[model samples]
Target: MRLVFGLVLIIGVGLAGFAVFMAKDYIGAYQAQLDAERAARANAVPTVEVFVVNRGLRYGEQLTEADIRPVRWPENAIPDGTFRALAEIFPDGEKKFRTVLRAMEKDEALMQVKVTKPGADAGVSSRLSAGMRAFAIKVDVSSGVSGFLRPGDRVDVYWTGRGASELGGGTSGVTKLILPGVQLIAVDQIADSDQSAPTIARTVTVEVTPRQVAALAQAQATGNLSLSLVGAKDDTVSDAVEVDQSEFTGETVAKEKEVCTVRTRRGAEIIETQIACPE
Candidate 1:
């Protein structure tokens, strides 16, 4: 009876030990599965190649592909084809990373001009080739008129001057007339891409042929230049009628009329009255 009891006890302990072993094995499998799930979750986030570089570069600074290195992926990533981010990604170099740009143009002077650099006085993409006529007139476009004005905003030129009144009161007045087909050679003042509350300048320089430049200079010396936004599709220059009325005296019409005076001996007399008008 003792041997029978001992055998039964051994059998019971053996079964308990097997159950504990199985439980441990199951727990190990579960832990391994959890670890794999965490690893996959970590890798699921997409990582892109970003460039980190030093800054404060001149227009023609030499930068190799090695000068720029890949950085940690950022959330609000820059788009694939924008040139604006080049300077932002590579600020003054001490505070943040910068990205340098290479010139596609062969001209050294043109290459040295940092088109991407901001602030007023940045050269317009409307380049001035040697002997090409350009006008040095000021243009005032409301910064609020559009989100921003880049080197390439198409604009229509308008003039505010004294001219014969389109309204026929036999009078003249200061009038704002659309110059019709004048093209914006360049946006004379470009607000810095990195600044707030961009400013307006007295004159925005424009590129014109020699004749146009002459006409523009005359206009600037005499009349006011205004710009109307034409948007992207309307950059074409149409036929324009330009006149020189710089020496306007007042806002009235120039009239020559005959006045009849009945007197004892006089029959009729004609008199001329000059009316100055605004354009």
Candidate 2:
């Protein structure tokens, strides 16, 4: 009887120990959750309702009530030019004439530069800034950087035409640089800011000054134009870059001469003669 009693006492003690261990574990988990909640409350910041995009938006797209949504943004973290009130984004709950000037992602804040004014169209003329002109150039697979060119990239213009050297003798076909560091405004008809993929476009428009427009127009009319993409960090100045067949093929270039000389013999005496050479 004593042996059986001893066995029962040991089993009870073991079960009691396991129950205490389980209770301690449960208490620890509950305390951890409570501490987390307290921290969240202490670090909370003030927030305000602001207008944001409900879905991805493209350039030249008209704005509507369904395209925007209100979200709680931190008061101190609000971006510049963002609209805080719904009326500011769309007066009287209407956006009938506004359009997107640039593409925006979902939940992005609405900014002044990202949209056009009331009754403004998103055409090419609207995209140009003050004092900037748009010039379109014909492009092919070889001249346009093989469909890798896109809007927002800077490029250098090259003219592949025949022209004479400064000495003015015979004309040699040469390729020369016309413009450098020009910003591309659009590819074909797409001016969206979100386009990052390679596209094959027949025509590309660039932003230039009034003088640049004249120079580009003359170069295009006289010769074939080609575009070269410029790197974001490249600072090398491109000017007077020219190459001819002789230079490219490493052949000897003939110098332009105004006069030619010939050796003649008269009565066993050597005589030198000068003659005019045709250009």
Candidate 3:
């Protein structure tokens, strides 16, 4: 009986030791995995919730709470003017909704410049900057860039007309660049910039300052106005461009010879004598 008891005790002790060894290995592995997970979380990029359009939206459409949703965006890479919360987009708890100024696609961030203020309509006025005015200019196939202009394009205005003889330009009309890089706010009556198809617009509106409006008005009244499309990425300032019939025909203008005269009184008659012009 004593021998059997000793063998049973030894086997029980061995089983407990083996179980403890396996448990220690498992705990060490679990602790290592937990530390790795914590390190990964510390290195992860920070993000913030920003509002984005739930679906594609068009210009002039009203934006409501249902049309937008929140998405996690990298905190450092968030775009300027992006709405960060519902209160920022809809302030004062007012029921007024904003109107889209530019078309937006699904998941696009909402920006202040892309939408009008609450209860405001998206119109040409909204696109104009402070102290800017909207002026309408008539256009045709030849002057409107073959109907390829859109609402958001910039153009150079050219005035072609006869100048007074005192100004050195004669009956042959002169084409001069009146305006450089003026922004187009509306093509015909449409203010939306999403227009892709080319349509021959009879009249196009441009955003300009009060001084520019006066100059354009006078130029349009006295001469014919033509528009030249400017490249979207072109930022070089255009020099003063003036083309006349003489330059177009490759003819050089001739300068008249200077003449000088002297007057001498002889009795009752006044005589004029020719002399060399002063140096």
What lDDT would each prediction earn against the true structure? Answer: 0.49, 0.85, 0.91
For each candidate, give its TM-score against the true structure.
Answer: 0.39, 0.64, 0.89
The superposed Cα distance between candidate 2 and the true structure at residue 84, in angstroms, equals 5.3
Model 1 residue runs over 4 Å out of place are 1-43, 54-67, 72-135, 138-158, 169-203, 206-222, 226-279
Q: How close is candidate 2 to the true structure, as a TM-score?
A: 0.64
Answer with 1 or 2, whichever has the higher TM-score.
2
**Per-residue lDDT over 1-279 for candidate 1, one digit per residue giving the tens place of the 0 to 100 score:** 999999999999999999999999999999999999999988776655454443434423444333444544544564444333345433454333222233333212122223333322334432444666556555444522343443334556666566654534332334353444444434445422233444454455555567766666666576666666666666466565444333364344445554544334335755555444433
Weakest ten-residue segment in model 2 by summed lDDT: 89-98
Question: Which is better, 2 or 3, measured by lDDT?
Answer: 3
Report model 1's TM-score to 2 decimal places: 0.39
Query: Can you rank all candidates by lDDT, best first?
Result: 3, 2, 1
What lDDT is reached at residue 235 by model 1? 49
Q: Provide the global lDDT of candidate 3 against the true structure.
A: 0.91
